[model samples]
Target chain A: MTGTGSISDIEPRLGYSLRVNGRDHEVDGAWVGDSLLRVLRDRLGLSGSKNACEQGECGSCSVRLDGRLVCSCLVLAATAVGREITTIEGIAPEDGLTDVQDAMVTEGAVQCGFCTPGLVMAIHDLLDRNPAPTALETREAISGNLCRCTGYGRIFAAVDSTVASRRDAAS
Target chain B: MSVAIPETLEEALQVAAADPEVQVLAGGTDLMVEVNFGYRRPASVCALHRIAELHAQRQDDGEVVIGAMTTYHDMERGVIAAALPGLAQAGRTVGSPQIRNAGTVGGNLATASPAGDTLPVLMALDSTVVVASVAGRREVPISDFLVGPKRNALGPGELIVEVRVPHLRGPQEFLKVGARNAMVIAVCSLALVVDLERRRVACALGSVGPTVLRAFEAEERAAQEIDWQTGRLGDPAFAPEFGRLVAAAARPIDDHRSTAGYRRHAIGVLAERALRRSA
Candidate 1:
């Protein structure tokens, strides 16, 4: 809180115990109106989730809260006291990326990479819900997320590839 | 700032009754916008996230009571889609996916935005908005809740608890003319509910005036004079008259979205299209 100027203008410090990246941690200094995205990125130093739109219009700050796909930018830190948060930084193992992340790279879905974190989080949630989804279903699932760099053909392909790979492995 | 997060309706009522300055936060969709745009400032906020009773939807004997905090996305794909297609469409037409996930029916009603996609639909549905303050709870017709554009009849500590929409045998539809296909505000919007069984119709026009309006003259004309039962509606000649009547009902003003004349024209076309589509 030192480098961050004007603590008086912000909400007071509170405490939150959330299961993040499969580990439980006691995070203190929770503000009243501060978004869960801000707490995750600024407090816990998990900077994978982007804060492109403070409103819920953009999915750059998408995260999984209690296994539900939600825009962390719109959720207050105080409201997320007893929930579980899964961000992009938590997608990797102790060393490298998960299969989805690996597929994203293999399929060339990473362009400017600004929107990739949110897209990845949203896709992860979607895949968790429906491991094998139709193309239309996949489109509907990620309709909330916005990507400025690529034309989205590659990203769609990446998701489709992951779905195919997972199915192939299951067989 | 004090944070009063109540778990139940009674507890919420008690908290709201106790504090006259408490601003009601439902889903934080509209409240967040207000704070970001500096439209509202609250020293204390009463969060209604945990009020499970207000979110319940059940047939209480005869009428369907929908909890005011229900999200728009739910309306698009489920029970609401079957019951009230027009209202469900209105909910589906609101902001992007993220916004729809966060925005609530109560938030839309409380904002009182003339351009709110749900307002005209609610008005045509003749929905009842339940407002609870420290005194007690009372139901106001949707027409009355909309005092003006972005103006409402809510008291300082009042909270919109539920919006009960009467189930009617009708062909209902909602149409909007916005600047874009998605994530755009309405230039002019219309919601038509035709209860063919009762030989009456309810027409509401929004985003064209100070408030969402019921086409009283048109409704009366259709109810009292015109006979849809004894006549033919699917004929090609019916479109023009429907358009004219719908156009006559609107009171639009020129704004950034479109011209008044354009809105009037679009309203007529939309109304006719809505009717035809429902047909």
Candidate 2:
């Protein structure tokens, strides 16, 4: 047998209160088995997180589960319990797009746009951890993610410029 | 259905022991993939991730007792890397950061795959497996625990509790050949433990056999025949014999990823390198 059993055998009742997108929202009707990715997009109307590979490979459904970048698509909504989840929607404070988002657009880091949201979430996490990462570090940080467009040269530059701006602002 | 997440080690152990058909989950890097891909269907599952006591490391009586829940990251950090150098090197190669953060040596031993990254390291280190059940706990050498590929001596209700590796005699080395560097499973991987003071050597290979295997004959040949004085394997004859010994140990089969011939060749090469490194 591939696994010990199927997840279909162990569904729980869905009444957990999950704080998402900087707001406390009760996932009342969602099932115990609903993925955090689905809950964020469908219930919370935070559609920025995409579900390309729910298996944690694509990195498309990436989000910050309590500040740790995780595959939201792979995470069960029940696991959230009372953790704060930060999707792309929660990245900027009502001030429009954040500096990182602006850098991606200004530097033409946006490609076919399918991988953009995941890239955004990943880079935000990376910067949050290391505000000043080298080019190689930046490359290594996002190696978990796959980008089909824009050969990543401009994307790297975009992140680099954003970091430079953040450094200057800190100074 | 959602598997029950037991919060305590005793509760988790009791649940696992009580449920005859329950499959244990820790990290879920391997089993989860298999389940998601329609490989296995477990009915009742017990997750051991949250248990507090399982993630421990201690040194007692010159043997390093690594808790079953200890993550690969934990091994890479401190005394674990010093006590089990080959195992540490192997851990460094297992999957990516996320996978390493989640995977554990306990899970590695339980899976008992021929290609487990830590298996060769454990075998070379003469690691001991501590299996726990409702009856009691039993410790078995890795040699006896691994019956074949994807098989083990573990009985139902028994789970691997910890791996005890004796302190290394000297610095050890590990190397693997795979499709690429990051997140690649081994085509052939080997670990070497070099005992400089005692003039002894141990070598083990993964992915060339039905299970992770030891080159015991090769190790003996090095100790008895090879020249530790000159810092080299003295007998050219021993190299051929060692190759033969290692290749003979291979229970590898022809598959899409590799040919039997390539596996044999890789086994010999890794055996030679590991032996020489230990020397």
Candidate 3:
């Protein structure tokens, strides 16, 4: 347990029950050292959250833990037990997409699509916290999210469109 | 292999006392990186995020006591920023919103990285680290708490309970040189504090030595040369001299991030700029 290895080699198998996407799930045979990202993608079958960088540097695995955006790769699955988790799959309605997602689609912000879910979640969190953010604010909000494609021009456009639509809806 | 989520300080201490090998997890900003990179596999982890007492903050006497679990996000706003603006500024420059939301000052101190953004601010502010165990509690100055790079003075079973930073006497400033603006580690960082009450000025440098270092010679010269009322040195020549002394105080080494010569030069420029800003 004091050295790096597969989670199974670190500890005996265990079960961790967690709530994800407004549903209760009991994940069994989970490795004690498994990260929340691993459990979400492997055990729970939630592939909406990508695991590009297991490190916190890349925001590819961004998810909401108890309503706060966090890097899922950094959180231990055991520590997340009983906590509320909202992934990219949980953000939108069953049949439709979130406003941020919709704006991203309309703005052609998706190029490779690997980083889109994280950018979408990051923007959603930002707008949830700050409804009317300036362009600089939007850039700062998504600073952690790295988009290797589209040169971020389209991403900024997507954010701008989402803000405009939100204001229009409010009016 | 197991994570112990303690709801109380006493329980955490008790768990630590029972198992000295247990690693304390505050925000998991540093530890998780190590785990993710396959650098460490801790035998056991004591999760301290649920400890309410570790998240409490209070003003006692003339100082502010910030609990160990106070996140960088907390430092960027509210009373913590008002109490220690330099520290708050350093916190704002750490990583991004996601990292700041989960990174804690106590965790940064415990990691004891020579490049830690908050270390210089803690050194300049003359803050105190409060450690607790089942035995009792004790306070250690920030200078003594950090022993070396990635090392600290935490004893077995002892936990950093809180950090006590004295209320600001005057303006303070923190400046960092990095490869980029956001989500970058400091190549060389500096913090300057003006103490009008004591008529003294202090400076600290980071990422230039084995640990955060105080430019004592520069501090003495600045304190004696600067006009306390105006917060500026009478002669412009003193500024560069002070910067030279600050650079002389550092013992930087060449690494992938930067060269020793560049680090020394950056510290000098940062020192002068910090002085001008403080003035």
Candidate 2 C-alpha lDDT tens digits along A1-171: 346665443433456678887788877766544567878888877788886755666677777765667667655565566568888888887869989889999999997887788888889878987998988778766765668788888889889999999989989
Ten-residue segment with the worst summed lDDT in candidate 3 chain B?
Answer: B228-237
Candidate 3 chain A, poorest ten consecutive residues by summed lDDT: A7-16
Would you estimate the TM-scores of all the predictions?
0.89, 0.83, 0.96
Model 3 spans with C-alpha error above 4 angstroms: A1-10
Quick one: best lDDT, which candidate?
Answer: 3
Global lDDT of each candidate: 0.78, 0.77, 0.89
Alpha carbon lDDT at B123, candidate 3: 93
Which regions of candidate 2 fall more than 4 Å away from where they truly are?
Answer: A1-47, A53-55, A63-90, A95-100, A124-139, B225-248, B275-278
Global lDDT for candidate 1? 0.78
lDDT of 3 by residue, A1-171 (tens): 578887567566777689998898989987656788999999999998899878777798999988888889888877887779999999898799988999999999999999998889999999999999998888888988888988999999999999899899989
Model 2 docking grade? acceptable
Relative to the true interface, what fraction of contacts does candidate 1 keep?
Answer: 0.24
What tens digits encode model 3's per-residue C-alpha lDDT throughout B1-279?
Answer: 467898899999999999999978888878887877778877688888888888877778888899999988888887778888998899998987888888898999999999999999989989999999999999999999999999999999999999998887788999999987778899999999999899888899999999999999899988888887787777767888888999999999999999999999999999988887776
iRMSD value for model 2: 3.7
Residue B76 local lDDT, model 2: 85
Question: How would you encode candidate 1's per-residue C-alpha lDDT over B195-223 as one tens digit per residue?
Answer: 76777778899887888988776665555
Indicate the residue-level lDDT of B266 in model 2.
83
Q: Could you give candidate 1's per-residue lDDT for residues A21-138 as a string of tens digits?
A: 7777677765556677877888888888898867776789888776667787777666665567788877778788877788889999999899998888878877987898888778
